[model samples]
Target: MADRSFLQWPFFEDRHRELAKTLDAWCADHLSVDHADIDAACRKLVSDLGAAGWLQPTAGEVLDVRTLCLIRETLARHDGLADFSFAMQGLGTGAISLFGTPAQQDEWLPLTRAGKAISAFALTEPQSGSDVANSTMTATLDGDDYVLNGEKTWISNGGIADVYTLFARTGEGPGAKGLSAFVVPASLPGFEVVERLQVIAPHPLATLRFNDVRVPKSALLGAPGQGFKVAMATLDVFRTTVAAAALGFARRALDEALARVNERQVQGAPLFELQMVQGHIADMAMDVDAAALLVYRAAWTKDSGAARVSREAAMAKLYSTDQAQQVIDKAVQLHGGDGVKHGQKVEELYRDIRALRIYEGASDVQRVVIARQTMGAFLGGN
Candidate 1:
């Protein structure tokens, strides 16, 4: 009922259509995962998702953007936890899928795809949130291994990840070029989850500390000096997925509000019949559609062979996330007291949608990215 027709849009191909149909059926059968034990639930979801082959779309011989967006958007609409579980698998190992050596891919990707191994991307540190270049975590060469020392905060799947695609400072050079990406195993002696962060919405997040964690040189992803580029490239691929998740939240919020409005009574009539209420619904609907466009457009552009989708992804993330917050708020307003009531679906979404806007490149950071990209494009006479 929430517009399965998006797949019929020109942005998608036959394979994408097939994926949407299959995932829609899968979501219908699988209910929202219980989060009484969030960690266990996530682990279960990951295994289940992998078994179902949903993780396959995250990478491929031919990466299909429309299919990825369709899967993410559909999953997010059904259950946020499922979306997170699926997304992290793609993100944590994305660098390897895109740029890893054949041996590296064989070692990690199969396990990740099989849900036998959980993954995390360790990039943000206590001192460097959006300022990735300022990360002070050091990975010093010691014989055949790199000795890691520092912390990564705000990491998703932090406590549970079996493998981490970590970035650290390898040289004294300024800016991003001196950084490096490495595949770190959580079982290593010096790596520990220092502190588990309790967020408004429950998920496994933590501050990870690496004190002399030794990683084999074979674990290095890409080249030592190419870490920044690796990070950006990985983000460029996954950021659109973030927007897809936000769009799904908006869609669910709209659906929930519509259902409530049609059933709830006002002055001797249903709320949907009221003119002011109709206006809110109209705005919410428009926002949802606009967000879908931004999300899918970025996905399509990137998959269609754009070198970098920075501008498109920034717009999608900024607009979809920011709009999702507003759309969910409006839904809550319509539901009134029950909206904010404990254990309500919209209530949970209200909290969940907040972080999407803040993480994976915040709305403010996206504006800067868009403006700078636009300026560069115009100045270059493109």
Candidate 2:
């Protein structure tokens, strides 16, 4: 009903089409969750996703960006928390799946892939969010262990995760070069959930504190100084998936608008018959399709063996998220009073879409990335 035609695009293969169809059907039947208990809802969603083998891609030796995009798009369209649960599983353990040692992978991947454990990527701090180089969390090496001391805020699954792929300053050099990545279990001594953050849309988010928490050398994700690379690489894989999620939200908004305009009467005639209303639907449709194109293009580029899809991913994330916010706004306007009223689908989407533009990389940050990359290529430096 939402539109399966995108599956036939050249960016996707037969396998991707099948995945899209299968997941869409699965989401329709299984994505329903109680919003009153956010933690329980997220945990159950992750478990259900794992039981159905949907989280298997998160544990793969090589991340399939296309698969990640397709799943995120479909899940977001159905349920926001479902998308959050699935995306965090991939994002939290992404560093491990991409860089963890054999023993590390052996210990974590099975549980993560099976949905028996929740994972978090602890990178954002009170002083740093997009500015990874400004991170102040320290991981001091002490004999066979690294002692973590600092705090991370706005962390997805912060209070609920079983394991964390945490980035901290290890003094290898300066800025990003001095940082290191580690796999930390939530049960470590002195680690605490300082506070749970409630946002416009409900999901399990919190501020975490690490006070002299110790992890063995075996927890190091890669070489000590390669944490920046690890974080970037992981984000490179997941950023386009962010765009896919935005695309999903846009599509759902359009769908709700279509159904509303067709059924609602304005004066005596159907709202859909109005020329101005038709213009809004037209713009929403165009934005959805355009965002889908950009999302899939970035995903396909990454999956096709580009070492990194930074510029492409940034563009995809930028255009898709900004466009989606606009698209959802249009959907809300077309619904008149019902759009802003609580419990309406479009109203929920209005809340759901605001974060995509701000997270992973903000729209302004994306513009900087795109411009720098374009100039680098033109100047023969990239």
Q: What is the TM-score of each candidate against the true structure?
A: 0.98, 0.99
Off by over 4 Å in 2: none
Instruction: Report the poorest 10 consecutive residues by lDDT, candidate 2.
Output: 373-382
User: Candidate 1 on 1-382: residue-level lDDT in tens?
Assistant: 7877677889888988887888988999984678899999999999999898888776555566677778888899999989999999989998888878888888888898888899999999998999999889999999998999999999999999999999998994788978999998899998989999999988899999998999999988988878999999999989999999999999999999999999999888999998999999999999998998899999999988998999999999999999999999999999999999998989999998989998889999999999999999999995
lDDT of 2 by residue, 163-276 (tens): 999999999998999999999999999999999999999989999999999999999999999999999999999999999999999999999999999999989989999999
- Cα RMSDs, all models: 1.1, 1.0
Top model by TM-score, which number?
Answer: 2
In model 1, which runs have C-alpha deviations exceeding 4 angstroms? none
TM-score of 1: 0.98
Cα lDDT of model 1 overall?
A: 0.90
lDDT of each: 0.90, 0.94
